[model samples]
Target: MARIPTAELSRYLFAGQIGHRGCLRASRIRIAPTSSSLQTRQFASHVESQAPTATTVPPTPLRKQLKEQAKALKASGQKKKKKVDNQTVPGWELTVGIEIHAQLNTARKLFSPAANSFNDDPNSHVALFDVAMPGSQPVFQPETLIPAVRAALALNCEIQRVSRFDRKHYFHWDQPSGYQITQYYEPFAKDGKLELLARDGIAAEDGESITVGIKQVQMEQDTAKTTAQPGEVQWLDFNRVGVPLIEIITLPEIHHPATAAAFVRKVQVMLNAVDACVSGMEAGGLRADVNVSVRRTDDKCGTLGTRTEIKNLSSFKAVEDAIIAERDRQIAVLESGGVVEGETRGWAIGSTETRRLRGKEGEVDYRYMPDPDLGPVVIDLPLVQYLASSSGLAPDAETDQLIEDYGLTAKDAISLMALDDGARVQYFYNVLDALEQKLGSASVDTIAVDRGLSTLAANWCLHELGKLTELSNNLGMTHKGECKVPSADLAALLYHLHRKEITAKVAKELLWAIFRGEISQGGVTEAIEANDLWFHELSEKEYSDLADQVVEGEDKVLGEFLRFAEGKGKAYPQGKLMFLVGKVMRAGPEQRMDPASVERVVRARIDEVYIPGLKSKE
Candidate 1:
């Protein structure tokens, strides 16, 4: 048989299955006849006669391939060729860095007795030390150091034994101290890395991992918050003045905005796992400052373009959008043969854009100095180890175990854990253990516990407890330790539902009444009995009576049902069947038969009366 040219083979493959035009024109290439020796000989002779002779010098590897392909196409000149764009946009690359601020889970401020809580009255949580009064001395809280150390360890960083706090001086209405205490010369932790997984897009891998290096994780105090001014002066809230915070600085190693957003989300999950920070992006508990730069493929990391710092990006969406905008801005500048200026910029969340805050020349020095009053923080290694090993396994690990052990999807496990801010996971496990003992099971696993307990906990906590807490907060209700609806009662209510002593609807109503303080322990069962909320057990006679009413009362619905039974209907009688069941139940209001039983009875009666010949179908 005639040898197929390699170029022809590649063209066959490419044209057959590659591009849009290639795929469309693929049917034109016919397989050479291989049946008879005579046919093969003729084909071979024809191919050789058309082939080039040795007098023409052979082409180079790349040139030979191109020439062969061009010759093949020349033979088929009647075919129209599509043009492809090979024009490259020169000097375009994205560089990214991250500045993460994690709110320390501390009881007090880094240098004051001010309570580190959000949503408190303005300035109510502030102390004299927070205001930086002349005589006020800076005293570091031990609780503050623990979480900072924990965060550093979680990031896989080496914690410094002797890290000093410096004065990051800047003039702002919120800063009563005139300077913020932070680590500059010597940071608390260094040399850590994080892995992020992109969620979507063509460039995105469903779980494609990217690792970013952590330059430092330093302990700092948060500045006071400023409320936007409508008329004149911006209202300053000093309550957050001295709140302890950890700043996780990442190297400018990221190349894509999507990857950076993914990294931030993973970090947020990690923080929540360790209970180091609340993942409240809007409330400023976990905030990010994106540092973006651009360069060519050949440019060195730092030599690319000037890095622009996008400040106080609160959400993952904001981080990704701001980085994209910044990347495009830098790319545009570079394409125009202009240099991008190094500056700090503020992201407008509403418009999803960035505006320059200050140029490099206008940068604050933030004079560095150690706090004279506060001494060195000496970390006890044993205590650190104990905290890591015994405090409880990370939530991520538990979530993974739940998925593997229970055959649950990752989304389900994540959803279950995220319910009630992660309290549901713990409560589900606890309740499951109690239930297993009650049921006399020998060591039930996480999967069984998840499947068995997830629904109950979700309803009780997410729906019931959430509603109660929200109502209490809204009404400014105070609990004197004797308020209605204790945790045990909530557990008992779930238990009752599991035992089939109460229906799901009745349980919800009971929970609401209990939460509202309308039902107390003395009237618990009485309230249920008075409301006639118990799950009713239907007798055979009652079931038969309801079935008869459903068959006789609605002639149109009965006709549709008969058609479905006789296999003469194009569509199922679902709506009419439901209406028939409803009519039957409406006739006997005191009969509390569930919709399931009603459907079962109606279907059975329809089959017996209308489809006696269809008995073999079932």
Candidate 2:
């Protein structure tokens, strides 16, 4: 394998003019003939003379022979395989690069004081400077710099003490400023590497490690969003304008599409673990542009082929599809005697194809000069170190501690923390601490925060609370912010369930009602009582009487139960047994009797009446 520059290969791959002849040129091989052919012929003739009257056949051409051999090899399997003549088929390699843009969780925009929020109203968050109005001057927000530095530190990047912003000029409807204020020449952070682990395939040590070299991580302002409608003019929303954006440029080290997707997912997870990004693919909070190129394996990987940039791959599936389609397109072009052109491509998700967007352009020659209106971003080393230390706690470390301290499996801990944002995780930690205090010191020793509280909170929030929020959103009953079911209420519900005051099922119902705003005060118990919802608990005599009545009312089911208890029936029919249980439960106020207990009681009565020799457990 030869080393190839990602840029050169990307250009050719995107150009799409590489021809089949060029590919064949790289696969050409040399061959020589020897006198062994005559000797072999003479020996075959002597052997024929000594045996039967058969003539030896002449040898076939090497290409034809190889083709036949290849066909035979393929025929031994389930499907037909294409013939690859080493002399004519080119061996290709893929090199992948990525540029990731993460939105900073800052309160204000990079150059403006407008709120950095995903507001519904368009252009409401834009300032004069964000729109590049005449006489508008850029004033850097000192607050945005800390999060940027924290993000760099999280990625293990070296932070540059002094970084400057440059104007990247581009013309687009969403770019109302006519130029993007970005870091081009002097970035705040540089030279980091990410180790990516493969999600699938055999665990081969050689292929497991994928090192992504980070060229730079710079802070920039996000462009406004554009909403398009057919036959109507596109609408621009400048709400995202001046929003702090971090652009991370990676060296072209990825070689596979699936690998690229996995890398992106890992990066997303890492960013989300901290509060750097929201990691919402659908909302475009984090976006990626994939740079892909191909080359022959034997040729120097640096003998650059055409490269193409797949812009704004929002989802992991889209990233994988774009890479595959681009690779196939490049191969098809090369096999057809054409050259791949250097260009940018847009992934048409509907068609599952890549279409040419524009010719490739180098880093914009905005003649980048430091803005005269903005001063150099100076980082106080002590402040940076303090912020880094106070950056709460990493989810990974918290998750590990939860696993160790809470007597939970690492897998369970990871699952619990998987989708939680840093704020949510901290909130959960506080909830768990409160739970520990309430339960006393003995409970703390026996119950891990993860297993006792965090795990329950994770399930309740992800399943119950999430379901309620989704339902409320769908019904337009409440905005996400207003659908407030506090963690404390959830903890209270769990505590009630833990104390056996209410069952898990009843607690879920209470939670649903509370989230629906049915509860006005107190907790779930008060809500349940106020709603006149009560769980019926039958005494021993009541249950005995109900069992007797059920036996008398349902002779057929009773017979079946007797047979099942005697081991005479074909099987314990789940459908028939459940039907009987339902009939009995519905017959009286004990309608909510636990299904398992009902089954056990029915089975015990059947054993006592029909199988006197065997115990109920038997």
Weakest 10 consecutive residues of candidate 2 by summed lDDT:
27-36
Per-model RMSD to reference: 27.0, 21.4
Q: For residues 449-531, what per-residue lDDT tens digits would candidate 1 score against the true structure?
A: 65656455545544565566654533221121123455445556666677666776687778888777788754656776787
- Please, what is the TM-score per model? 0.66, 0.68
Compose the digit string of candidate 2's lDDT tens values, residues 22-131: 35433211111112332124223323223322232454443455467557656767442221111122477777899999888788988888788774444445566765
Candidate 1 matches the true fold with a TM-score of: 0.66
Q: After superposition, how far is residue 614 of candidate 2 from its true place, in Å?
A: 8.1
lDDT of 2: 0.64
Name the best candidate (by TM-score). Answer: 2
